[model samples]
Target: MLLRLPTSVSEAQQCLSEGAIPVGGATLQWAVWQRDGFPEQAMSLREVPEANVLSAEALGAAVPLHRVDDRVPEVLRRAAGGIGTGAVRRSATVGGNIVGSTLRCLLPAAVVLDARAVVLDVEGPFETDLAELTAKRPLLLSLRWRTPQASGYRKLAEAPGGPPPLVVATAVHAPEGARPRLRIAVRDGYEVLAESVECDTGVASVLDALAGTAIGALPAEAREVVREQVTELLARTAA
Candidate 1:
């Protein structure tokens, strides 16, 4: 078992280039460590200043979920705060949420945020638009984006209240006219099923649009309930 804790981004990048798996806040890594003990090569990012920084210069990927400022962009803050529980929030980093699983909410939120995710390899920094990473899994170094006017997010789980199957995230910025520009991303369980940029003038319109995109993936009985909840959620946020 071996652990390399890097104090700076370059040190972390150097370790990663040497094939160490990146680990920040170990929430997702614990299960793997339990089964595999220590990985053949591992890097712990807890002490890395780059991994904990959150600001206009750094993206959410390096930020700890609980430490994000609530003022930067409301949607991102809400998304980060929703990762798991209090304990998980303390340990989980945004990069983990981005690449962790098929059931994560951050990527969809990233779409609405129009975020850019970066990866620093030994070759230097390689960047990709956030939307590009939704389908393909990419290890991230930092995530950056411009803050919008207002944004909202909703996660709906099955009866037990465990991992959610459906997540609806929206971002709004005032356009040239009366209606605000809307960007939305919808995830049903394992994959992001759909995303749209449109002007949804009313709640019914938004419900219809999301339902049309995600209805087939959800159970028949649950569709109406989803619609109801999504409607209320959008309306509440809009107001």
Candidate 2:
């Protein structure tokens, strides 16, 4: 396989236009490689300067999970730290975590934070909401979001070191005078179950309202677990 390492976004775009598959971190690509073999051509975004930017409001796609520091939202930092082992965290890129076929901790955090993704495809660069970005599977350039008033994250795995079956992220937004708006996102290993913003409803009522929406697809036992965990997370963040 031919691998193209581009130092600039334009160079990377050219490689992409030539049909090179964009690779960030290549952690997820390991599974793809094992299943489908390597692509004929691959472009590494790690060397692209624009894909390395990091700050309070923006994180480049190639930025490693371990590099997600306190400068970003607390929920994001916590989610990044909890992804995997130290080595895995050091190697996994934010973009890969967000767009990978398997849901990762960062996705729920990004959802609650309302992050927007910048993507580069063969046509050129474009920006889209993170909620809508993953399905296209484009080359993510970076993610940007405004800081929230407060945020929290939680995850529940079946085994000691197994992949989490459920993960939840919550953000509290207090508009002047009105009740605090609570944004919640839940994910089970493969897809998002629910993402919505609620106001004024107590935890029980909110869970009831979500009975047929976010947790509807889950089995009865799994739905109870989600409710319990989501209630705990919401209580903590809402406190």
Candidate 3:
């Protein structure tokens, strides 16, 4: 049997307690179904949650739960691109992105912004970093993060439309009085995070330096052209 619950985690838990698997988003399940034709009892969060997953407020804002077919911003859509195809985006939940750490995941952005997620369980509401929690436990409810300065997200696709094989860098241009921050996530690959510098100077120089710095940190010797392109983009943006 399938069960649908309100967007609240308490409601979700109620279903889980009643022997439901608690499918926040159907991305994973749908993927299995599409590829392998697996059939199983499934619940949809699309309708019960009111078809919303995110909302912005004044630090006390509450977001409604959502289901499939709801539209979001281009940036958000891109951010949720970890799920890949169009069908997945429609049915996927932000909570699933938080849990799976899929391509173009939004949690990284939330992490960059120092956001917190309010997770409600049978106990009560608990707060934590959306990204950090993904590293520890699967998120039980929602995620929240503070706004960043200037934010930039770039993905290095393997082929033309393939998943990123290298790095998907998400940067938060530090607040007016703060230092710039960057998160370079390397997929199916590894990057050195031991030492790095934060620049608040001109954008061109930073991008140039980023390429060389990143290249220096890498182990593979495939090519050095990617660095050059990144440096060039930084230059153009700075210009």
How well does model 2 score by local distance difference test?
A: 0.79
C-alpha lDDT of all candidate models, in order: 0.68, 0.79, 0.45
Instruction: Pull out the clashing pairs in model 3.
Output: 46-67, 51-66, 51-67, 52-65, 52-66, 82-103, 115-145, 116-144
lDDT (Cα, tens digit) per residue for candidate 1, span 106-149 = 77778777778776556665788766665565557777777666
Locate the minimum summed-lDDT window of 10 residues in model 1. 192-201
- Give me the runs in candidate 1 sitting further than 4 Å from their true place: 47-49, 56-58, 131-136, 161-163, 175-180, 200-239
Model 1 quality (TM-score): 0.77
* Shift of residue 33 alpha carbon in model 2, Å: 2.9
State TM-scores per candidate. Answer: 0.77, 0.82, 0.62
Model 2 weakest 10-residue run by lDDT: 191-200
Q: Give lDDT tens digits, candidate 3, residues 1-239.
A: 44455555456556544545445456565666678764434433444342244544112112211331124322233455644676656655666655543443554345444556665444555776644565665334554444443344444555775544553333344557666654333333422121123644654555556557544456443224334433443454355
Candidate 2 Cα outliers beyond 4 Å, as residue runs: 34-36, 160-164, 175-179, 200-213, 216-239
The Cα error of candidate 2 at residue 22, in Å, is 0.9
Ranking by TM-score: 2, 1, 3
Model 3: lDDT to the true structure: 0.45
